[model samples]
Target: MNGSIKWINGSATLSPIKFIAKIDNRLYDLNHFDRDDFNEEVLELDNLELALNLSVSLYTPISFLELSNIAKIVDDNNLDYKKVDIFALRDIRTDKNFNTILNINNFPESIRKYLTLKTLPLKSIELITTFSKSLQDFLNGFFISNISISYQKAKIFIDNIAIQKEALEGVKYIDGFEFADRKTSTHIEIDNALIAINSKIFPMSISTDDNFESGKLKISFYVDKVNSYDKFIDILNSNDKDIRTLIEFLKGHDLGL
Candidate 1:
């Protein structure tokens, strides 16, 4: 989770906040937690009330001067302004000044659980897409971990495969042995399975992580083909039908496509 969205004051309608010598103490009380856990089995997202205290910072020439030369910039108007981008002296950063809560409405069940609940990774895709848009709009910028492709192996972990094993019970393989006719552990759940989902817009492969217990079902997007955040959001919001599905998924009530 190490990325920041850089935003600047472009619209005149958006007023630039004035520099504050001291910040309010109430801002310190609010916690900055994006994910919340209820024991090991149950997981949920925090900030339902959405009391996010965003700190403010403004880069200026005055904040970049040293204490000994503070009066020089204020008294002399001929000073070079190119150094405005560099902070040579005192820090002008402020603490969290205020909090804001957006109207995300009521979502059923824990979002944390639903995302990795053994789907084709579509739920997690929608979650990240919508989350990025909301956070980018709320704060001038937002930050999160980067999700990239891992091509070390084609297949990852898989749990119970009774359903799949049954479906392909009598299926023949390239070698000659049948699915049920195998005398030894075939390890079909790990090496081979029809779980990878291919799409024209975004090609993705979902599998369970080997770290977690085999009994506890989980979803891992370790080998995601989507490269960038903007690209992932674009893939999900490419059409009106997908957009509606994302909205319903966020509400945690949709049956899914």
Candidate 2:
């Protein structure tokens, strides 16, 4: 609600493609049927089977070649940037069978920086794929913010949704906490083991022939860089203690769907 740019929570249309990603509470209900639907349901439930996920969904989709070109352009313009990836369960309370797809000892510094005590399990996803938004206009705002997902390494994400819901219920409007009850669809790009191109968000709906996987994760804080980029930077630089606490609490509440 308060940021540099306006925040658009859910939508069926975006620049990259014409699909939707919706977040809601339906108890693993499927918008469709089959493996993809099951996967999406699990993702909506917080990537239970997968265990963990961390991704950045830009407004537009960017190809790997484009990323290379941008990196070159940034270099040509003398900008600072870092690319990294990590392999581990970054943030979860328990350990079921979650394991990193790669060896952490060989991870890039950019990815290793996130390694902390709480991130013992190895299962993460990262990428620099394009967003539906034009690269020139990325500063405007994000359809969705960068997100990280994890719970119990060995535990299924769906099993804990109720716990998160109960926690949210107990804290709603308490000490400045609240909940939203609306369904929305959004487009996003993720670079986990698999890459999702022209992916859309929607409520649990009819299944499609394409093997696409998506979820409805509760997201907060829409960063608006277009209108007040400086203000956004100031907010980040300020690092208000309350903001940090709020973020932690939001993560704790987990994905409401």
Candidate 3:
């Protein structure tokens, strides 16, 4: 449970609201059934479903739920879940264009650039862990991409994350291979990163952003910036030579409940 858990053989996505409601109902039932068993809040569950839906509805097109299913597998199976999480990792970009990033139409022109990682189906929860680390590492390091940055206000200063400075001399995860002419670090991978915002956390992933990037880690927390199911798994194994597998956790393994 502490190490990597490869749950899916291919990519999949879950409805966040359903997930939230499911877990919420699960937690409520857990307490309701055991109210007489323990009076000390034996299982702590946070009701962030309504709040998140408020925040989420502002962004994506969410469907109306006819009803929310109650979760019982964990309780029924007697699984000990210390935490349950709601996570989101979003890359809020005004533009959605990757034509400049990688020219799939003409590979020959980009051949001079170091070849990027193969799109391996995720092997583990790396979708959440690895991707997040990569994004953090990328910004922390002096990495480059085909795209350039331009600000309406060039004078704007960044309140950057603190770094040891000395660590910069060492190689970073996103630091690409060194060529005779220069070094290359293409693509920003935010694989399997656990992200937290206040009491909420999630993987938004490639597990590579696999923040579950969209589901729960342990009832624990994680995140990646990108959103949506199809995109999540695509990025995770997008690097591994083995071809990445599994986008989100399989429902069959959700707490074994």
Give the alpha-carbon lDDT of every model. 0.25, 0.26, 0.25
Give candidate 3 regions above 4 Å deviation. 1-46, 60-128, 131-139, 143-169, 172-257
Residue 62 in candidate 1, Cα distance off native in Å: 79
Each candidate's TM vs. the true structure? Answer: 0.17, 0.14, 0.17
* Each model's backbone clash number: 2, 35, 59
Task: Compose the digit string of candidate 2's lDDT tens values, residues 25-77.
Answer: 32321222111312232333332111111122332332222233333333443
Q: Write down the worst ten-residue block by lDDT for model 2.
A: 1-10
RMSD of each: 25.7, 28.8, 27.4
Query: Distance (Å) between predicted and true CA of 43, model 2?
Result: 50
* TM-score of predicted structure 2: 0.14
Weakest ten-residue segment in model 3 by summed lDDT: 62-71
**What is the alpha-carbon lDDT of model 2 when measured against the actual structure?**
0.26
